[model samples]
Target: MGRTSKIVTGGLLVCALVAISIPVGKEVVPGLFPQDQSSTVTTPAAQLPPAALSQVASVSELSPDAPLPDAAALSDQLKEALKYDGAGTVSVYVSDVLTGEELFSADGWTARTPASNQKLLTAGAALATLGPQTRFTTRAVTGSQPNQIVLQAGGDVMLGRDDSKPNEIMGHAGIATLAKKTAESLAGAPGPYTLAIDDTMFTGSTLNPYWPTEDVAAGEIAPIYPMALFGARYVAGELTGPRPHDAPVEVAEAFAVALERAGVETIGIITRSKTPEGATELGSVQSATVDEQTQYMMQWSDNYVAEVLGRMVARKLGEPVTNEGAVYAVRKSVRNLGLPMDTIWTVDNSGLSVSNRVSPAQLVQYLNILLKNPASSAGQELKGLPIAGLTGSLSDRYIEPPSWEAAGVVRAKTGTLNLVTALSGYVVNSDGRLLSFAMIGNGLTDGPAPLRTVFDNAATVLAKS
Candidate 1:
């Protein structure tokens, strides 16, 4: 997955309003069943409340006692909320972070498509295996031909072309700076040179086969490459468009363009090859720290950063640096952390693939493990989740009625596919006790917007419990 920016729309509120007055139409429903399944059965649509409400949902109004509401009580409220959606199967799991006592569970152990929630696993694995301070290096070395330079790929996917302006996500390693240094090394020597790209750091397919082919054009993913600039490609300051087939070539071209702009003559076509033996080091740039990169991945659901981190973990484990290798390494790392392995399977780190399966228990338990040791590198992953109504994907969410109480109080990683919606994170209950939860909605026929309210309202219920 290449780093691609997404457009958040206001359609969610519109759908919520429509759902409140009239039942969701069959035509508007997304198929809930997995694509591999045979049929798509339409389920009765759930009714949502009107978007306009007199009173704003507020957490300041509700408070609970020391012994929090028991499991039976919590289950009743959550079930009632989920039943209102009437779109798909709902999985819920919640527990006390301090006592480790289960507060509620509804099909929590069943495997379901996780969407972006899978990034939680990837983030944990990267931090646990590679540590927080790990940095990727991109270097320019002497090429085989005189005046020819080789750009070595060292897993810096967010490499930028401009140094004056920092990238929106990856703020380090500017290609302009590298070009300046490279030009300094060749100060008295050459007139024009050809640039060669060395992208062998990653050893497999540039694109994951399991991903939907159409997602590329849809701007949901880009070619996975070890070396890319500005998230592979950005147009008119917007991160959109299909990934170029030869991403490394495009990177090399950008490097060449940078070199030329820096008063260096770049002649001949850009080629892909390894740096020659004993080649002198010209210049280098290091990527943003792994932790920073992970935070960006979670913040924007940037698939590219997530995939890159997965490969970094794979490299740390001495496994292949391919997509399959990343998946295997991430799962292994999760298991090594003593988290549940069964009922959890993933083919890609970004959760762009529908084949990815995870259980609510796995997600909730993973977070709890990290929350218990917040001082450790792996534990830092919890800080990456989007805060309700504040940052990242949740910037515009949690502002609606009913679920509004969770605003500024709940922090969670969200997941959404056509017919799936998932929320997993920690919330401070009315008792002031921190709790962890994982909720997933699959087979959702009416789409995620209406169901999103259900999930948000459920979390609000927990916050007030």
Candidate 2:
């Protein structure tokens, strides 16, 4: 009887230990593990900030037959795979903009750094504030000294020799043409020539500390004082480069040299400065509409163009040109439209700043603002987007078999960076169902394929569901 008592006592102790583990299991892996490891693997519920436990609870509760009543049982399987797909946290949301019905929402409120996906938001903002028909300009003025000339800047991102992709060209005709014509105009006037470049149009604000300074100086972000006479980057083959800026400077200097080759002699120092107004518009050029600029900005994830345009918007709205001022302008303009921007944080005009954060729902909500406004001149440029596989950055996303969800039917923006990937856009299903979806993957490495697949799969499911 003593030995029996000892065995029973031992069993009771083991049971008590197991009881402590049950909560751990329920808290960590949810349904599968029977024993709890809260002490070892889970932070106590009280210690976790609201988001940690909330994401788990929201992702783990998919019961297959509820939200997606159409899928019945397969729903839970989908949720399970997404719960821990290597992305520390993944959020997905689907909304019928036409009916304003949110069909599925999983951790949609959590804001994450969206990488290039932030481009979409910038594009949206550009369209909402800057008119769709907007164009940037670059002009030339003759300096006080004969044969000397100044090329004015307008912070045009598309300024390049190549206007092949429409608004992709930031500013002007050709520096060569402008310079050459000036040479011809002064053929008999000045024995020696000198050309001065004035970039006074844009205030020399800090060129984003987040961007590589060397590359930016070389024009990686976008050349400040750009001069593209013939087509730029697109057709700009061969030639050596200091950077993007160096390339344009070389081009401008080459034009001066070419004028010498044509019998004109330049003795004046070629320098950079701003050209005053009332300055002659010697051979001016206009950029494409804002729609075209947005398309290209997304295609290559061009942060420079987006941010430059952002500053331009700030200037237009009477905001200061500094980073802080630019974002202040963005916030004011967005709020002016009646959209709630309390959760949106803009550290820089571009999403290059790590401090930038926004939610999937907010993106959709922003898009909805454009959709509902038909009256906004700036909001109508959504046409510049690549229609899935048709063109631009999304040219190869969302593989569909000759249906509405196919390449040409669904149009959207893709975002990504280290451990963070996001896609937000409007899609139409084969059955004429219109859907606006936002998928954000955080805790993944910086790249697009994995993020692409998640969105593609989600779109496929969204289309069918």
Considering every candidate listed, which one attains the maximal TM-score? 1
Q: Tens-digit lDDT track for model 1 on 350-389?
A: 9988899889988888887876666567876665777666
What clash pairs does model 1 have? Answer: 32-443
lDDT score, candidate 1: 0.74
Report lDDT (Cα) of residue 96, candidate 1. Answer: 80
The lDDT of model 2 is 0.54
Report the alpha-carbon TM-score of model 2 versus the true structure.
Answer: 0.72
lDDT of 1 at 424: 93
Q: Write the per-residue lDDT of candidate 2 for residues 1-465, one digit (tens) a residue.
A: 245434433333343223223322222111111112442243222212233333332112323222322433334534643444443677777676655567667888888776666665566667667776677766556666555666665555445432224323343334445455656665677567566666544455546556545544544444433334322343432222334434346555755675676576777567775565466655555666675666567655666667766777777877776566666777777776666889887676556555678888887776666555433644543444444444456544543332223333345666655456777776443233445778887767545465567566666555444
Which regions of candidate 1 deviate over 4 angstroms? 1-66, 164-168, 235-240
lDDT of each structure? 0.74, 0.54
Per-residue error (Å), model 2, residue 371 = 2.4
Cα error of candidate 1 at position 423, Å: 0.7
How far does residue 303 in candidate 1 sit from its true spot (Å)? 1.0
